[model samples]
Target: MKVTWVWSIAALALVAAACGGGADIEVADAWGRPSPSVAANGAFYMVITNNTDSADHLVAASSPACAVAELHESMMNDGVMGMAPVGPAGIEIPANSQTTLKVGGLHVMCIDKQAEFVAGDTFSVTLEFENAGTVDVEAEIKEG
Candidate 1:
């Protein structure tokens, strides 16, 4: 009876660990807000931390609030600022490292807004990764 009980507990623990029972990657202070007035498109910023000792890449992103969702990076050319889509290569997050997606750098650009993103509201963005797979994160809208 004692041996059976121990096996049963071990089986339960294995099942729970396989079903995301362990600690997960932590994402905090994720904020996205519409650009100031006159800006047709807006950007989203967040910090992704990889707690595990495994590498990950953010490959794609999608949002219901915009007609088009893409990973973008800002650049300067001849004193003019421009934004362009990230190519096939995805953003890499090394093991035990944090990647910050911020303004004037790398961000998720929501184009052709379907509905205005308001502060204090939350929206979902699905992020596909190479190692970590797909992670759906709730982005809080805030005033930038």
Candidate 2:
């Protein structure tokens, strides 16, 4: 009986080890606009740090705060400002590197705002990744 119990414990430990002992990729300080203050649209920004020694990409994103969520980039086209969708070829996070989505840069544009996000309010957003799967994060609404 003692032998059986010891083997069971060892098996459990092995299983835990195989499952990485609950280790997961870390995300920090994720926040964004809950809704546009004056317009029907808004944008969100966050910093994503890839702790693992592997390359990853932000494939997709979604939020209940808006009718549509899309990855966008603001750029200058012959002195004209333009924004466009970044499709399946998503934002890349190099191994051991960090990427920041900020104003006038790569960001998630929330279109057709559904709810207003005031400062101190939190909203849920799901980010899809190539390897880490879907990570649901809360964004704190703040002044842009």
**lDDT values for all models:** 0.78, 0.80
For candidate 1, write residues 1-144 as lDDT tens digits: 999999999999889768743434556677787544355677778898776688777888888866778899998899999988887887777887888899888898887766677778887888778777778888888887
Q: After superposition, how far is residue 111 of candidate 1 from its true place, in Å?
A: 1.6
TM-score of 2: 0.76
Report clashes for each candidate as comma-separated counts: 0, 0
TM-score of each: 0.74, 0.76
Q: Give the TM-score (vs. native) of candidate 1.
A: 0.74
Candidate 1 has an lDDT of: 0.78
Instruction: lDDT for model 2, please.
Output: 0.80
Give the residue spans of candidate 1 off by over 4 A: 1-24, 35-39
